[model samples]
Target: MALWALVSAVGLAVDDRVLVGAPIWAKPFKFFVSFAAYGLTLAWMLAQTTWGRRTGWWAGNVVVLTSLVEMVIITGQVIRGKRSHFNAETPFDASLYTVMGLTIVVLWAATLVIAALLLRTRLADRATAWAIRGGVLIALVGAGLGFLMAQPTAEQRAAGNLDTADVIGAHSVGVPDGGPAMALTGWSTTGGDLRIPHFVGMHALQLIPLFLIALVLLAPRIARLGDARVRLRLIRVATAGYAGLVALTTWQALRGQPLVHPDAPTLMAAGVLLPAVAAGVWAALRTAPEPESVRTKTEPASDSKEFTA
Candidate 1:
C-alpha cells in the first residue's frame, strides 16, 4: 500500500488527465493511504485482544484482503482514465462498482466483528482500552456514511438519469462532482461534501489512540493526569467529544453546508459542545484524588529509600 501511495504520488505529478475536476490519481492515492492506516490499526487492535484472539485475527485479515481488492479496482480504473465510484457508463464499469460496494460491505462487517471481540477482552489501561473500543465503534459509523453517497440525488431522480446517466451518484450534494473543489481533497466548496464527515469519522481509530498518548506524555507536567482514574475520565470526555464532532460534521454535510462555511446553526452547535467538553475535563481534574505517584514524589528521603529498598 505504501508503494502504491508513492506510485500514485508520481502519477499525480505527471498525469495530465483530469477527472471530475481533480487529478485522476487523487482518489486512488487517498484510498491507498487510508487503507494502510486502517489495516495497521486493525492489526494492532487484534494484538491487544485476549479472548477471541483468533476471531480478531481472521477479521483483520479480511480487512486486509478486501482493502487490497478495493484499491486494485480503484487504481485500475484510474489507469483506464475513468472514474472509480458511481461510474455506470458501461456494463463493465457498473459491474466493477458493484464489486467495490460488495467488498466494502464485507470489510465493514469484518471490522464490526473485530470491535465486538475487543469489547469482550479487558486491557490493563482503562484509557487505552476505551480508546481502542470507542475509536473502532465511531469508525464503523464513519465507514457506513459512505453509503450516503451511493444513493442518487433528488436531481438525478427528477432528471430521469438513473438509467441513462454516466454516473448514478455523487460525493457532493448541492453541486455537481466536477465543480469548484477544495485543493488536494477535491471536496466541493459550494455545497455539502459527504467526504468531509466520512474522512473525519473514519479516522477516529487513529485520533483517539493518539489523544491518549498525548495525555500520557503530558501527565508528568500536569499532576491530575498522574491518577489513572482521572486520565480515564478525561479519555471518556474526549471520546464523547470526538463522537459529537462526528455527529456535527455529518449533520452539517446532510444539511448541504460546506465545512469551511458553516452557518449560524453549525456554529451554535459547536458553541454548545465546546463548553460541555471543557466542563467535563475540568470536573475530572478538580475532583481527582492526589495520585500515589505524586505522594511518592513528595515522600521523605528515608521513606523513599525504604520504599525503593
Candidate 2:
C-alpha cells in the first residue's frame, strides 16, 4: 500500500507535456502500482468488515482510507518530482493517472454511503436534510463513474453481449469526443472523463442509487393520500429509470453502436441512457409525493476535505 501511494504521488506530479507521451525516465510509472494499492486497500476493507458492523458505512471508511492513501501518494510525488504532476494522461496506462481509476470508484461509493447516512438523522432542519441528500447524490454520481471505469475494456466487452459499448474497436480505446454531460450537481472531473467505462460506471452508480433510494428514504414520510401500496409502486416506477440507465450503459459498453459517424457513437450513448433517465425522472417529478414536514436549520457538516480539487 505504501509503495502504491508513493508511485501515484510521484506519477501525477509529472509535467503534462511529459504525460502526453513523454520520454522515458522523466515519465511516471503507469498507475498499475496504484491500482494494485487500491485493490489491496479494498481487500483490507473487506477483511476489517466482520459482518457485525458492516453497514454501507464500511464503504465510507474505505473511501476515506483510499483518499488518505492517495494524499500520501500525491504528497510524496509533489515534494520531489521535476514538475507538478497533473492528471492529464501519462506515457504508461497507469502512469497516465496519479491514482488509479478503481480507487476513485471505491472512494466515490464511500462518499455516497456517508452522505446517505447523514440524511437519516432528524437533523431538526430541512437544509441539513437537503444538504445530506445533495451530498449523497454527488457521491453517488462519483461512484457511478468509478463503476463504469471498473468495467473490462472494449476487448473484454466483446467477449459477451453485456449490452454496453464495446471498447474493442479502434475508437473504443478512449472517451468519446462529445459525450453527454453527467455530474451530480456540478461539472466535476468524475463526471467529465466519459471516455473510460470506469468513469461512466462510477457516475451512473452515484446517480442511479440516489434516485432509486429516494423511494425508500422519502416515500413513507412524505407520501400522502392514495393507498400505501400505490405510492410504493409509484416510487419504484420512478426509481426504475435509474436502474434502466445502468442497464443501458452496461449494454452499449459491451456492444458497439449501430450508427457510424464521428459523433454518432456519442449520440447513440445519450440516446440509450439519457432519454430513459429523463423519462423516468420526469415521471417521478410528475408523480412524486409532496413532503408533509418542514425542515429546520442546522450546521451543514462538510466532509473531511480529504484532497484538493
Candidate 3:
C-alpha cells in the first residue's frame, strides 16, 4: 500500500489538470494512500484475532478484489478525462459509477463481518480487543455516511442540468461540486463538506489502535499500572471521545460551515468535550493498580498471558 501511494504521488506530480482545475490524478492518489493505510491496519488487527484460516483467506480475497475494482474504475476515469464519482456524462460513465458503488458495498460488508468476528473472539489482550472493536464500529459509521453522499441534493435536481443517467450524488454540499478547497485535503472552505467526517471516521482503525500503542510506549508506567480490564475502560473512554469528535465534525459540516470557520456553538462544544476527555483519561490512569512487574513472580499466569497477547 505504501508503495502504491508513492506511485500515485508520482502520478499526481505529472498528471494534467481536469475539469475541476485540480490534478486529474489527485483523487486516485488520495484513495491509494488512504486505502494503503486502511488495508494494512485491518490486516494487522485481523492477525490478532482467532479467525480460522479459510475465513481469513476469504476475507482477504474480498478486500483485495473490491479495492482493485474500485481503484481501477477511478483511475480509468481519470485517464479518460472524466469524473470517477457522481459522473453520468454518458452511459459508460454511469455504469462505472454504479459498479464502483456496488464494490464499496461489498467492501463494507466484509468489514462488518470482520468486526463481528473480532467482537465474538476472545482476544488475550483486553485493551487491544476494545481498540479493534471500537475502531471497526466507528469506521462502519463512517462508511455508512457514504450513503448520505449518494443521494443527490435538492440543488442538483433543481439545476435541471443533470441527465437521467446521473443517479449518483456528490461529496460537497451548499456549493457546486469542485469549488474552492483547502491546500492538501481539498475540503471546501466555502461550503459544508461531508468528506471531512468521512475521512476522519474511516481512519479510526489506524488512529485508535496506534494511539493505544503510543500510550503504552510513552507512558509505560501508567499502562503497566492497569490490568487489562482497567486498560479496556481507558480505551472505551478514549474511543467515546473520538466518536464524539467525528459526530461534531459531521454536525459542523451539515451546517454549511467549513472546518476552518467554527461558530460559537462549535467552540463551546469543544470547550466542554476537551476537559471531559482529559478528566476521563486522568481518572482512568490514576485509579489503576500498581504495576504487576512489582508483584511476586509466582503471581497468576493470567497477567503474563495478557501482556504477551
- Highest-scoring model, lDDT: 1
Error of 3 at 104 (Å): 0.4
Q: Which parts of model 2 are misplaced by more than 4 Å?
A: 1-18, 21-60, 78-197, 204-239, 243-309
What's model 2's overall lDDT? 0.42
TM-score for predicted model 1 compared with the true structure? 0.93
Q: How should the candidates be ordered by lDDT, best one leading?
A: 1, 3, 2
lDDT per residue (tens digit) for residues 1-309 in model 2: 456446545544653433123322232343334335444433432333334245645664686577656545444444444222323323432352435454665776565554444545453333323433443453355346444444455555556654342221222323331233223211122122323333333343234334435545664565442333433444444344444544444444435431222246566766766676566545545554555578888775676564446
Q: Tens digits of per-residue lDDT for model 1 on 1-309?
A: 989999999999999898888888988999999988988888888899999877877888899899999999999999999988999999999999999999999999999999999899899998899999999999999999999999998788889958778898889888788888888788888889999889999999999998888889998998777788888898899999999999999999888888889999999999999999999998888765653554335546665567674
Tell how far residue 122 is off in model 3, in angstroms: 0.8
For candidate 2, the per-residue lDDT at 107 reads: 72
Ranking by TM-score: 1, 3, 2
lDDT of 3 by residue, 104-164 (tens): 9999998888887778878777888888889989998988887778887768778666666
How accurate locally, in lDDT, is each candidate? 0.90, 0.42, 0.81
Residue 220, candidate 1: Cα error in Å is 2.3
